[model samples]
Target: MMATVRNPARDAVAFVGVGTTPYLRDAGGKSATALACDAARTAIEDAGVDLADIDGICGSSVPTVSVQAALGLPAVTWWSNSSLPFSLLVIEAMNAVFSGACTTVLVYHSSLRGAGGSKTAAADPFRVHNASDAHGHNAAMTAESPSGTYGYCAWAQRYLDTYGVGRDALGLVAINGRANAARNPHALFREPLSMEQYLGARMIREPLCVLDMDPPVDAGDAFVLTTAERARDLGHRPVLLHAATSGRTDRPFADQLEDYTISGKEIVAWRLWEKSDVALSDVDVFFPYDGFSIMALSWVEAVGYCQPGEAGPFLAKHWSAGENRVLIDGRVPINTHGGSLSEGATQGAGHFREAVTQLRGDAGERQVPGAATALVTPGGFLWNATGFVLRGG
Candidate 1:
C-alpha cells in the first residue's frame, strides 16, 4: 500500500527557507547559471534539508537550462519559463503542494542580461522573449521606439498627469531607496540621494529619470517551499504559506486597461484575505512590490493598509525610522530587507525572501523582533500581482 499524505490544513503550506546572491546590474564573476545555483544552494542549506529531499524545481524564465542541471536535481517536474512575475511562481508552488505533485520544490531565477549578449531568432526554453525586449524603430532601444506594447514612459506619463504627481513626489522614491540601501551591505546602491540630486539625474524617459527606473540588475535569488509537517521534521522554523492569490486585468498590455487608475492590488488582496483565514491586522509586516516607488504606494492603498490617495501620509509615519525600524504594531513588518528599491530587484523573489527572513528571524541586523506573521506581495503594477501570508510555526 502507498503512504497517504494529506494537505496539512487550511492555508498550511509553509515557506521552509530562502537565499539570494548579492544583486548586481552587471555581475562580473559568474554567469547567470552559476549565480542562480549559488542562491539555490543557500536556500536548501538554510532549510536544513537534504538535496535529495527536493523532488521538484520551479524555475523562472531567464537565465536558461542551467538551473536543474547545475543543482543536479533528479528532474524539474514543475517550471515556468516565462517572464511571468515571481509571485505567480509561488502560487504554482502552492498548487504543486496542494495537488501532491511534489513534496519539496525549489523556486529560483537569475538574469543573464547583464552580459549584454545578443538575442537572435534562436529558441531557448529558459530565455522566452518578453515584450520589453521587442524591437522595431529602435533596434537597440531608443526613446522613440518602444521595445514592447507597454514600454516605459507611456503609462508613467499618463499616471503622473492624471494624479497630478510632480517630479518631487517621484524624487521621494529615489531618496528613500538610496537611504535604505546605504545600510544594506547586500545592496548595490549605497549612497544617499537628495531631492535636488534626484531632479538633476539623467531622464531615461519622459517623467522617469534614470533613478526612477528599476536598475537593470544581474542577480539570482531562490527559495524552498514544502508542507509544514515536513518543515517540522527538517528542524527549521516553518513559515506557513497561508495564502496565495493572483489576479489579472482585462488588459493584456498596459494600453488595454480602461482605467490605469483602477488597481488590481485590492482584488488580489481581497482574494488572499478570503482564502488565508487571516485579517489585515493579523500580518506583522508587509512586503508589497516595489518595482517603482509610486507603485508601492499604490499597493499600500489597494491592499487596505490605508485609503486611496492617503498612502503618502501613511508611509511618512510607517517608514519614519530612517528606513530601519519597524513600528511596534508591526507583527508583519514591511520589507525589512530594503525591498527592490534598496536591495535590488530579484524579479519578485527579493520580496519573497525578505518576508521569509522576517518570519524565520534570519534577517540578522535587519530582523524584526518576534515576527510571527508576514505578507509577501510580488509581481508588477498594472499587470498581475501575487500575495502570500506566512506565520511562524
Candidate 2:
C-alpha cells in the first residue's frame, strides 16, 4: 500500500481578490509589463490592501523587477519567476504564504502573442537547432515538430481514430465555450456559435476547425493570496485554497507518450482529492483550461466526471439539450466566465479568476446558484497538469 501525500497548508491561504486587463486582439502600444501592472493594481484594490503590504510576487512570462518597480512596492521580501505552467505558479505562491516567507502575494501572467511574440520565440534562444528546423517536421516525428501544428493535429486525429468518434465530438466543446462566452461582457467573442458554423468553418488542422483552437491575444490576469484568516477580514469573500497539486506522466515527451488518450490529469485529480475534504459531487462549478477543445475534453475525463472516451457522448447529451446543461443553473456549470478559447487568453490565469469569481458569487450573469465549491483544472500538452480546489469562505 502507498501512503497518500496530504497538503498541510490546505485552506491556509485564500484568494481574496482577482483582476484582469481587457482581453484584446492587439494591446495597441502597451507593453506586457504595463498590462501586468494594471492587473496587479486592480487586484490589490479589490483586496483592499495597500501596495506596501505586498511582500511577495510570482509570475510567468514577465519580469519580476519590472512589475515590482511599476507597482512602486517599498520592498519585496520574496519574488520569483517560475516560467512553469501558470497553475504551478499559484502553487508556488501558496507555498510562499504557507511558509511565512510573505504575508500577501500576487501571481500574474501576461502574453504578447498578439504583438507577434510567442512562447516558442522566447524559448528559441534556449533550443538547439536540429535537422527538422531546416526541413519541415512530420506528425509522426512528434518531438521534432516543436513549432508546427502536427503535434496537436496528431493528438486530435488519434482520439478520433481510437474511439471511432466524429469531429463533432470536439466541436461540441467549442460550442459550449462560445455559449458561456456569450454571457460574459468581457469575453472577446460574444456571437452565438451554431453547429452548422462549427462544421463548415475552415480547418486549421485536420479534424480541428478554426473554432476548435484557442486564439492568441494580448492580456493579463492577477490574483492576491493571503492567510485565510486575513482574507476573511479583507474586502471581498475569500475563496479557500482547499488543494493545489501538479504531476507529470512517465512519458513526458510528446512523440513518446505511452498513451495519447490518457492525459496525466488523472494523477492530478487523484492527488487533489487526497489533499482536500471536498469531493467532486460537492463542486458547484468547474473551470477547465480550454487551450484546445480536446484538452478540455481530456480534463473532463481525467477528473472522473466520466469514463475515458465517454466525454464525446457526455458533452453531446448535456451541451445541446434545451436546458443548457452547461450553464450556471445547469447540472454542472463549467467555464462560467468563458475560457481561454472564448474569453481572452491570459494563459491559465483567466481560469483562476473565473473560479474565484464563481466561488464569490461575483460572476454577474453566469453566477452559479450557491456555488460554494469550484474545481479548476489547468492543463496543456500531454503530461503537465495541475488542479486547484476552491471553497467559499
Candidate 3:
C-alpha cells in the first residue's frame, strides 16, 4: 500500500514551447552564451507569446539575467540560475508560475566543448580558459575521484558483477539511441551502431567502452513554460507537468554514497510516483539520462520498470531487433530523440525537449504514435537526480 500525497502544483503548470539548436560536435565558433540566446529566441517564437508575456527566466550554466538581456525582454520579475542536469530549472520555473512569482517563463540550458572536451576544443583559447571536467566541474578527474567517468565505471562494473550481465545490457542502450538518432535530424550521430561495433569500440575505462559514454558537444535546448490554463491557449498543445522534483541523499559526495542502490534516483522516483496520477503503466514514452549508459540502466530499475539486475532481460525482451530500438511492450519508446549517447549531452535539457516534442505530436519521424504521457528521469543517480511526468492534453 502507498500513502496518498496531494500536490497543488500537479497539472497546474505545463510546457507550451520547446526549441533546440543543432546538436553540434563542433562549436562552429559559437559560444555557449550565443547558443543559449539562439534557443531562447526560437522558444519564444515557438510559444507565440509576446516578449512582455515572458516575465521569468530560468536555466543552468547561463545566468537568467544574461538570457533576459540577450533576448531583450523588456524585463523579468523572477529568474533563477540552477545547477547542472537542468531539471532543477524546469521545476523552479513551474513553481514560479504556480506561485505567482511569474506568469510565463523561459528556460534554457547550453553546453560548450571545453578544452578538456576534445583536442579541437583545446586548441581554442576561449575554450581553454573556461575548461572544466566533462560536467563543468573544474576538479581534476581521476580513478581516485568517484565522480564523472570514475563513478559510473565503478558502478557499471558492480552492476555487471552482481547481476552476471554482459556488455549486451549497456550495448543495447547505445544501439537503441543510434537507431533512434538515424531519424533525428538534430542528432549528432545519425548512423546506425551495431552490437559488434559497440563491443569492439576501444575501452576508455575497462568494462565501459567509448560507445558507453556520452560525447561532449556544443549545444542548447530551451522551453517556454506557464500555467496549464495559460498554456492551453498558446501556440502548441500543452504538455502538463503531472509531477516534477529533484533529489539527493545524506551522502552527498559520490564516494560517500553506499552503493548503486542508495542514491538520488530512488528519492526522485518515490516522490514522482507519489505525486502523479499517471502510473508507470500509463507512460507512453520514457527518457532516462544517458550521460553514462549505466545511469540509464539504473534508472529503469529505480523507477520500478523492472527489479534491480533485471534490466538486461527487461531490455532484451523489449528490444526491436528490426528497428534496433527499445519499445516497452511494443507501446512505449525510450528516448525517441536519440538521448545523450548519440544526441550530444545537453545535460538533461535535450531529454526534456524530446519528451515535450513527442507529447505535442511534433517529433516528426521520431514521434511515438499517440504519445500522451512521458516519464523522464534526468541527471544521474547522485545529488542532481530529478524526474518529471508530462502528459499531453
Candidate 4:
C-alpha cells in the first residue's frame, strides 16, 4: 500500500518579524556572538515582544545558549545550534512550534569570514585558524576544494558542455543578481555587473569564476516565529510557512552521486508542491538560493521552470532590460534582494529575509507588486537541498 500523506503542521507557524544587519566586510569589530545577539535583539523588538517571550532559539555558527544569555532570554524550552544554509534552522524552529515544544522561536544566522575565507580573514586577529566554513565564502571552497561547493564547478562545466552553451548562460545569473542588488540598500555589491564583467571575473575554477561565487561578509539575519494565531497579533504582517522539506540522493558522498539525472531539489520541489497546495503558476515571487550562480539556475530548471539544461534560455527570456533583472513572465521577480551573489552569503538567510520583506510589502524599491506567495528554494545539491512555500495573504 502507498504511504499516507499528511500535513497537519501546514501554516501552523508563521514568521512575524525579521532582522538583518547591514552586509559588511567587518561587523564593527564585533564577534559572531555579538552579531547573533544584535540580530536576535532586533528580531524580538520587531515582533513587539519582550525577551522573555522567546521560548526557543535555533541558529548556526554560534552557540544557542550563548545567544539566549546574551539577549537575557529567561529560559528556552527548545534550543539547537544546527548546520548552515538557514533552511534547516527554519525547519527545526517550525517543528518546535507545531509540536508544542515551544511557543516562540528565534531563528537567526550570522555570516563571518573565518581564517579560511581570505588572506584578509586570515590576517584578522579574530579569525586566526578559525577554518570553519560557516557559509560559502568561496575562498575556503577554492583553497580546500570543499565538498558540496567545488563539486558544482564540475557540474557547471558539464552543463555548459552538454548544452553547447557559452559563459553567458551562467553570466546572466550573476548580472541579474547584481542588477537587483542595485536597488537593495542592504546589499553589499550593488555596482552594475555587466555580462562583460561576469565573463572577465577571475576564474577560480575552470568553469566557475569569482563572480559566479558568493562572497563572505560579517552579517546577521534573524526571524521571529510563533503559532499562526499568535502571529496575527504581532507587529508585522505574518508570512505563513505553508510547507517545507529537504532532500538528498541515496548516494551520500558528493563524488559518488549521479548528476543531472537526479537533483535533490527536484525531490524537495515535489514534496513542497504537494504540501503547499499550489503549483508554479500560483507563485508570486521566486527566491532560489544563489550561493553559487549555478545553484540558482539548477533551481530554475529543477522546480519545473523549464526543462533540464535550459535555465540559461529561461533566464534570458525573462530578462527585464530596463530593470536589469529577471522578471519571470514579466511579473514574478527572483531574488529581489540581490541574492547570495550580491547580498553577501548568509547562506540562505538573505533569500528568506527578502521573501518575507516582499510578502510584507516592505521591500520598498524592490517590492514585487501584490506578491502574496513566495517560493524559497535554499541550499544546493548533494545532501543540502531544502525549500519551503510561504503564504502572505
What's model 3's overall lDDT? Answer: 0.86
Alpha-carbon deviation at 282 in model 4, angstroms: 1.1
Indicate the residue-level lDDT of 129 in model 2: 25
User: What's the CA error at residue 303 for candidate 1, in Å?
Assistant: 0.5
lDDT of 1 by residue, 228-281 (tens): 778888767788877677766666355556564454566577677776767878
Model 1 stretches with alpha carbons more than 4 Å out: 1-10, 62-65, 75-82, 114-152, 317-333
Q: By summed lDDT, which 10 consecutive residues of candidate 1 come out lowest?
A: 130-139
lDDT of 2 by residue, 206-236 (tens): 8887887777666788999999989978989
Clashing pairs in 1: 24-218, 25-217, 284-331, 284-332, 284-333, 285-332, 285-333, 286-333, 286-334
Number of the top lDDT candidate: 3
- Cα displacement (angstroms), candidate 1, residue 219, comes to 1.3
TM-score of 4: 0.96
The lDDT values for all models are 0.66, 0.78, 0.86, 0.85
What would the TM-score be for candidate 1 when compared with the true structure?
Answer: 0.83
Clashing pairs in 4: none
